[model samples]
Target: MSYLSQITSPTLLIDEKICRANIKRMSDKAARHDMKLVPHWKTAQSHIIGDWAKEYGIKEVTASSIKMAEYLCGQGWDNIHIAFPFNTLEIPKLNELAKTQSLSVQVINPVTAQKLVDGLTEKVGFFIEIDAGYGRTGVHVSDFGLIEEILLTAKKSDKLYFKGFYLHAGHSYYMPDIPALYEQTRDALGMLKAKYQSEYPELVTRTGDTPGCAVMEDFGDIDEMGPGNFVFFDLMQANLGGCEKSEIAVALAVPVVDINRDRGEILVHGGGVHLAKDVLVDENGNKNFGEIVYLNEYGWTIPDHEDRSYLKSISQEHGIVKASKSLLNSVQIGDLLGVLPVHSCMTADCMGAYLSLDGKWIDHAEGCH
Candidate 1:
């Protein structure tokens, strides 16, 4: 039977060869840069996925939250970095985890730094979350007063040691000019490292943005890198010119429940609940939920430009695809179609499980398995 025969519903299909190749590419880049590769686990949140990372010399990994870290601990990952801003409210859980594991968290300010100083019971490390133009979290790179205070407070407790700055450079996701953003982020992190290296000699500069790390050639003064989504490059990354569509490792297999021949739209039993609401604006400036692909005995393939198809919109449990005439006439009510998600990280998080093209069921942290 074909691999599609194993997928009954909206399931994330991982092409192991493609996925492993993606991991090797990033890990090789990290090695070429002579920087530590702490691959982020937020994209493929499964122990089986992480085990594949091990073949590429990845010993330390990055998690988006403390709960993810806790989940990872059971999977044999002792050295984990909680890349999210440290929440003082989870001190008890953090302490419990730290008792037997080496943990680090992102500290955004002096108040939280001081709170961690007073609350943490076990030895842990921290990275000062620097905004670096992402405009989402962390103190701005030029905010020396806040930076100095956070470092000063963190010094009060021997339990917390500084691990230098962490930058996401998330703007690379939407910015038209990626090289310019990478240059700006490199300069920002370099300046911070220069300012603090005198006092904090052991502090290591780390960055975790997929676009910046994936396309940029020169990583100046970056000690370690942790990009999660590059392992499963999605359409968003391809649209940003970071990776080609062929490199994308994951695709959602959804069963077609209806087909509208007049509207050239195919309704699939997959939507926000299965693929998440992340969209990529297509060449025609329409909100595209995902790029459409036709499934085969091997896996799936994108159609030619003349017969291109994609998801126009999605609801909680339905995806409306703006299908090409060829695709519209080709698919039946019960056929399976593949969708390369706009954002693999969000889609992977939504699906919570992976059915490998090899017919193996993999377990996600919160998957149906």
Candidate 2:
């Protein structure tokens, strides 16, 4: 039997070849621009994937939480940066990890900085998270006083040293096209560089957002890039023009459970519990749970008539695919159907682990086992 025959329920399938290709492309881009490519591990959340990244000469990486950092550290990652805001409650864990590894954490305000200073027993590096118009976290770009205060506190602490500024530029993901995305990235980075490069000439400026990093050609004066979602570009990334459809590396293989010829619908065992609740709205404002694809002995292929062959909606344990009558006729109740996720990060987190095409179970942070 084939791998598809073995998958009985919702299984996340990772194409190793496609994944390495995506990694190489981004690595080469960072090399050409002369910036550090400290990829965010929050996407793959796998030590095996981190080893693959090492093959391309990536020595440092970024994580979303202290637990993830500890996991990666145990896997022999010496230089790890926790990209999320500094949580004072995790100070003991942070100090313990810092004793063995070159650890860094992000600080958004003076209060957080002071807390780190008071709680940290081991020396740690601090990066001020700058709000590059994302409005999610970080101090605003114009808030120079708060930024300075955070920096000064870090400088005064023997256990903490100022690393630099970092931004996510998440708003770039909402742009209508690549040009708008690129422009927003440039403006954001330029604003930060212009404001602080003179005062802190040695501080590194780090930025990470899949949409901006994948689409933008010019990364004006950025010292580091930390994009994570580029590892497994999704339907949303492709739709947003960040990458080609062929570059998407992971897909959820679901077992077809029913077919409705009258309604042009196909039901699968996969749903929000497997793919997450993230939706991608099309140009016509049609909300999609994911993009459906046809599975065969060779592999999977995206449908030519995607508008009629894509995932329409999903619930806790069921996914409704609205496809053409001819397409719906081709699927059977026991067949394995593939779905490219709207957001690969959320989908991977939901699935907990991955099943590689070569017939191996790849362990992640939240493994199903």
Candidate 3:
């Protein structure tokens, strides 16, 4: 039987060829700009894929949580940076990992830096997370006093050493125009570098958003890139011009459960639980859960505009596909349909693992219940 027939329910299919290509493309871009490509492992979260990255000369990596850091460290990753804000509760775990690996964590305030200084028993690197208009985390770029306070606290500690600055321009994801997004990202990084470069010439400035890292040709004065989503580009990244449709490496393979000719919809056994609830709004203001495609020997083929279909809505276990009459008639019950996810990161997290086209099961960190 084909790989599609072997999958009984909602399954994530990873195309190894395309995935490796995406990794090389981003790695090359970082090299061209003379920046370190510390690709975030939170997207793939698999030791197998991590090895693939090492083949491209990637020595350092970034992760979102302490658990993920510990998992990757066990896989022999020596240089790991926990990109999330430093958690005081995980200080013991951080210290333990520091004894074995070159561990690093982000600190946003002086109090957090001081806590790490007091609690850490082993030496570890620290990055001052800067809020580059994302407002999600990190200290504001204009707040030099706060940044200095954190740096001072780290400087006073023998175990905690201030490394550099890190920022994620998440707003770039919403900007579909590549030029506009590139300018916004370049200006943000340039502004930060100009204000701090002279004082701390050795400190590195790191940027970690997929859209900027993928689409922008210039990285200004940023010294490192930490993009994670480029490992598996999704429909959302394609829509935002970060990548082409053919570059998407992973898709949800769902078995068709029902066909509705009257309503021109096809129901599948996959839903929000498998693909996550992330949605992309089109130019017509219609919400799309994902884009539809047909599986083939190599991978899958995205239909043309007129023949295109979309996942209109999804419940816990059911996904509604909106397509044309001819497209709806192309498949019957039990057929496996492919869905290009809106957000590959969230979708990969939901699935917790991947099944390659060659019939190998790739394991990852388990999803949260």
Q: Candidate 1 at 23: error in angstroms?
A: 0.5
Q: Tens digit of lDDT per residue, candidate 2, span 1-369? A: 556766888999988888999999999999999988999999999989988988987888889999888878866765799999888889999989898899999999888888988888999988888785679998887788998888888776899987788888888777566566556556766776777778777778888898888988888778899999999999888887888878999999998899988888999899999999999877799889988877765567876654447788999999999877667767788888889999999999999889887667887787411
Over 1-369, each residue of candidate 1 has an lDDT whose tens digit, in order, gives: 667778778989989999999999999999999999998898888899889989888888888888888878866675899998887889999999999889999998898998899998999999998987889999999999999999899889999999889999889887888888888888988999999999999988888889888889999878999898999999989988889998999999999999888888999999999888988775798998998888887878888878889989999999999999888777898999999999998898888889888788887877421
**Candidate 1, superposed: residue stretches over 4 Å from native:** 367-369
Write down the TM-score of every candidate.
Answer: 0.96, 0.94, 0.95
Candidate 2: list runs displaced more than 4 Å. 177-201, 306-308, 367-369
Q: What TM-score would you give candidate 1 relative to the actual structure?
A: 0.96
Best by lDDT: 1
Each model's Cα RMSD: 1.8, 2.2, 1.9
Query: Cα miss at 41, model 1 (Å)?
Result: 1.0
Candidate 1 collision pairs: none
Candidate 1 lDDT score at position 270:
93
What is the number of residue pairs that collide in model 2?
Answer: 0
Cα lDDT computed for each candidate against the true fold: 0.88, 0.85, 0.86
Report the number of the highest-TM-score candidate.
1
